[model samples]
Target: MYQFAITGLYQQVLGGEKLNQIEKTGELTSSRFTVRDFTELVKIGIVNSNTITAFTGMWLAFQLNGISFIQNVDVIFFTIVGSALIVAASGAFNNVIDRDIDGIMERTKNRPTMTGKISGKRALMVALVLGVVGTIMLFMTTWQAGVLGVIGVFLYVVVYSLYAKRKLVSNTVIGSFSGAVPPLIGWFAVEPSFSIVPIMLFLVMFCWQPPHFYAIAIKRKEEYAAAGIPMLPVVKGIERTKKSMFFWVILLTVLPFFMFDLGLVYVILATLLNIGWLALSIYGFKMDDSIKWAKWMFVYSLNYMTILFVAMVVISIFL
Candidate 1:
């Protein structure tokens, strides 16, 4: 009996250790998933690639001004990080505000906010911290940049997402204003002067967004309509939005010419990019399966902006 008791106790202790190990393993997995979810949530909110592009345009614009590398390195660090954080914060706030409506939209229904991957309260806290810290960092570089960052947050969260998004057909236009501000923030970070180049950059983004977003809106028309979102395509019909997109693309094409500082390289590239975009828009307008065309336009717009900005950087560096 004593021997049996000893064996049972030993088995129990071993089992207990195994259980503890399993618990630890489970906890480690949980921690990893949480970290991943948090990262995904940030990306979903900020649209990091687009944010980086806008920030890059600003940084390149500063470089074009002939600022020293040493001075620029630190400024680039603070400005990009701070601006990106603020953009993230704005995106998080948007997710929180739109969580309900987001659930109804097929494309947005699977988002962290919709799927409860992260709690809304936790998301808000993250946004607040990012916004405050980022704004402080931005102010360390330039007060103008900090202010522009704040304006971007307010416009995205309050003006565009909360007020305009549901109520106005011009919601894309309102949202574009926030998108355009990132480059301006970058521009003013180095050159506080309100110049034509920065304004043109802003206009380029502004014009680009309508077509970009309208294309998405067209592709997802039924979703927007079902979700009760007043997107241009949902409200204005496909043909109208297509016409609007072409008009914006034309404007985007012409605007770069006025930026004489951009030189032949940028002008040539911008012309090509706009022609392709304009041709695609015109084709979509005439196509029977306009949704497919819209999708093509959407993809092209992403490539268009990326190439245009890179061209801006290259010209700024070489010419």
Candidate 2:
């Protein structure tokens, strides 16, 4: 029953009449997701717990300030647990809302909600519970941080999911705003000060998302079309999608210069990275290499953001 309790379901696959027998379903078939299941994912490092839980740690690291390692533990527990709950809730709810749409798309057809492994009513209940718990955790940080968390939730669940996702061609843009706020939340966790630096960090992420998603839409155009989701590549042409991706990558490259006054190190490094990113963009459009190039761009986008942020943290120290 522990396994059943963990996943929140049990099944009764009975045999025919003559020798009818009841056998306990050994394998978990999912009736609902339990807290234990979600928490275990966080504990094991499958989904991201860092950006959610490490707000104070990121702030401390970015500042290059020394704090007792002991203190970090206390901070990590509260921030990670709280933010993770919210993220999980948001994710589960997104699955519930998009289940019908998801079933039409190849990539999402196997999700619990899409497959009828979890009920809509149950998923909604979990989302609300997790959101409330997450908000409470953020409240423990400071009212400002709590407000930011709430904004992220509201932006994602309501504005993006409900209103923009189905109606707008630029749904991803609205979604990116909420996604990029994690670093900002980290920036403000300790200091709670609004600055050009943190705002720039947000913009870099904000701008980077379009191209990243454009590449994805290009790769998954047919799935999106089948799903009746009007992604950029589906509504607009592939050529338009490529051009849009190129434009956004250029925008991401140019953003750092306006915000931070870094030395030649950043300038040279960014130029080289941008050159590579743009080259991939160009290859995606001009060459027959788009399928390969789109995948490359997607992979590199993850690293590029990580390296860029790390560079920012590094530059913040010496500059």
Candidate 3:
């Protein structure tokens, strides 16, 4: 009688499995991303803390060139938002194109597209939305701002990402133009006219990129080689890349002397910053071809740019 009762109870429990399956079926759901995931995507999109420097530099340029713009919050909003979104769009689109190669490199192996967190098609769609919306914001500021914004996008996406990055050894040069345009967009959103100072701003950023990028290329040459991207260090050899870096460092050191309107403080500050950078570049060669030195130069370059631009803003305001 006990055995019979136990068997009956087990049969009832077996039937409860059907109810459990029904409950689970009702609870079925798709994967949902967390806040942290969106944050990572933003980082991948290049809309992180570092972008403050770029946006601030542009805003400072606008303020210095046209002080009245500081009173116009709408223009300020458009310039900051438009420039950032365009940068994000460019980075996302580049990630989409470089996904395959990115997966092969240790440095880029865990990018969203590589890790399947974001599909390439999805990334492309995101880029499109960002680009279009950013352009619209800039248009609200001024048509010239909108035009420069679109040109920046085209240069980064088409000229650099699609063409030069894969085919030409001068990819860094081509890419620098896109990087340099944000300040011009900021300046023109208010000034709406061409000036030598804005052109000098563009040239400063343009000259700053080659040595900065090549230092990174030197540090990661093996990864770049494995990915089959002809970064300067990979195609031209590290020694030659170092010499090229040195040449740019020297040019970067001197470019500030011409920005006379930025005043003597800017000239002195920029000169001191570049001299430190130049010292790093020369010290790297003297350090017996150390990758450590390349790594140091890479880190120093970040500080160099931020400080140099901060000096521009300070001199423009206080001096």
Best by TM-score: 1
TM-score of each: 0.87, 0.78, 0.85
Give per-residue CA lDDT, model 2, range 159-268, as digits (tens). 77655777788888888888776666665555577766667667877888888777788888899888787787888878888888888888877865765355678777
Show where candidate 2 strays beyond 4 Å. 1-29, 32-57, 60-73, 258-268, 311-319
Top-lDDT candidate index: 1
Residue by residue across 21-107, what tens digits does model 1's lDDT show? 543454212322266566665664346655666576566666777777575787788888888888788777776666656767877
User: How far does residue 242 in candidate 2 sit from its true spot (Å)?
Assistant: 0.9
Better of 1 and 3 by lDDT: 1
Measured with C-alpha atoms, the lDDT of residue 75 in candidate 2 is: 51
Write the number of the candidate with greater lDDT, choosing between 1 and 2. 1
Query: Which parts of model 3 are misplaced by more than 4 Å?
Result: 1-62
Better of 1 and 2 by TM-score: 1
Give the lDDT ranking, best first: 1, 3, 2
CA-lDDT, candidates in order: 0.76, 0.65, 0.73
RMSD of each: 13.2, 8.0, 14.3
Candidate closer to the true structure by lDDT (higher is better), 2 or 3: 3
For model 1, the stretches where C-alpha displacement exceeds 4 angstroms are 1-33, 44-46
Query: For residues 23-137, could you state the per-residue lDDT of candidate 3 as single tens digits?
Result: 3454311144455544444444345422454465456656666566547889888878887888788777777667557757887787665555565445666778988898999
